[model samples]
Target: MDRDAVRLTVMKHDEPWAGAATTTGRNGSVPHQVGAPGALAESLFLVPTRHLVALRDVLRSGEDPEGVAVELGAAAATEGIGWSELLRDVEDVCRSVSGSLPPYEVVRAMSIAWTETAIHDAYETSCEDPLTGLASAAHLRSRLDDAYRLAERSGVSASETAAFVVVEIAAGSGPDVGLLRSLSMLVLADAMRTCFDGDETIARVGEHRAVALVRRSDAIRGYRALRDLLERAVDLPPLRVWVEGLPATSDAATRLLGELGRGASATELG
Candidate 1:
């Protein structure tokens, strides 16, 4: 059989939040209608019989379908698609047409895709500071907790090796000073990237206070880099910076930050 123009058409069921029906095409041609809507008001999609047969054969051949589903689910999740619900619907369609349960992997993939999509969406819309364009204090604290948990699960010594550093900028209050502070944050963020790995989390916790979580080994280097960056920028007004090291734990970090706000001395970096 000539297999050049086969395609799958997926139609979404009508619901309050459901988007307009979309079609997936192959051979650069629009999909043909399959049949009328089912009794459950589910839209009918026309999938190439050859593709379905191939997928069934692949499952029968002992391929790990669930794992494949998971990989695909993660990709779909990144795209903000509901993988699990879509998977259930696909299973229903497959059962109706093929008269057999869709492979477990197929169902699993959809579930994973849905889960991933939700997680990515939440992270993308998380609270962040406007001036520095970094995570907010609350969001940073939550991220710190998550990092700690992952490290614990992986048996890594992040708690002992990680360091939290606070960078407080002291600038005079004035219209010009406000503009200078904003510009300084941009420079500070760039300098921080040079001092720490790309994955380090930096956030503005207060008007003049920024915090960074980095490896203890890199804390001194990061501080010195930041100090140099601020000192060398002669165009900006003289801003006093006090860098301090705190415990990596969320509670301890928060407490130390509070103390720092109450006039803690600057930590001398070697």
Candidate 2:
């Protein structure tokens, strides 16, 4: 196809693909190469083998080109479908992308990525009580390591810094243990999000606790800001939280999280 014809005729099922074509084709030139797809794959942050098959399926077909093309374009349209139908193809595409690679390796990488994202998102959504996410204790362990690395890499280590803000929420006797648990998670999530930055991390390590890893040069101000934010975060039901501060030592994150978890249990009984 000529440059104008290619621009007009090539249908893009993914926004990232369209963006790649447009961005790479600027200055009146068509990319004229498969490299565009590779670049698009990189831009979307997709691991090539993980997404290549799925992306190709979305844009190509076998003998029944006309029929498949029509279906593809229809799926790309924004309307005229049941909710399930709308998502069904997209889900298939994602699965195909993830599935085509060597199953064990792809699954392993995706599992790690998925858990990391889940831990971060869960901490963001239900921070008041980290345990509400019911994440495996191992997830918090991983996040601690992640936080430690982030702090160490901050590039401004000359200044002293508070490494983490840990919160332990203990359930009281009569508050529906479940509701209090739920409330605690909400609060924990809030507290974590409140304290997090691009370089921060949050995770849950106990049945009723959460913690955040922060890198603030001014420890007192960071702690105060976090404390005040949690104090005003009202979504969570009544509960007692013990907050602690720790320096961003080379390996204090796990110990801090462990302390918060144990403290929550002790505080609950006391």
Highest TM-score among the candidates is held by which one? 1
Q: Write the per-residue lDDT of candidate 2 for residues 1-270, one digit (tens) a residue.
A: 011111001111112343343334222222211344233232221222223333445434422223332333333232223334323433344444443322343334433444455455555445343344433445656655655565568863311443444455545667477776766676667565655645555666666665554454433454566566766776554433333444345354455456556653433322
Clashing residue pairs in all predictions, respectively, total: 7, 13
The lDDT, on a scale of 0 to 1, for candidate 2 is 0.44
> Which parts of model 1 are misplaced by more than 4 Å?
1-125, 150-159, 240-243, 258-270
Assess every candidate by TM-score. 0.44, 0.38
Q: Each prediction's Cα lDDT score? A: 0.54, 0.44
Superposition error at 242 for model 2 (Å): 6.5
Q: Please report how far candidate 1 places residue 96 from its true position, in Å.
A: 60
Q: Please provide, for model 1 over 1-270, each residue's C-alpha lDDT reduced to its tens digit, 9 standing for 90 to 100.
A: 111212111112111113324365433222222344421113333333233333444555656566555554555455443544445445654554456667665776656655867665665466776556777666777777776677667876445556665666665787688787788777766665566556778876656667777766676666666666666665554544433444545566556545544545443221
Please provide the root mean square deviation of candidate 2 (C-alpha atoms, Å): 19.7
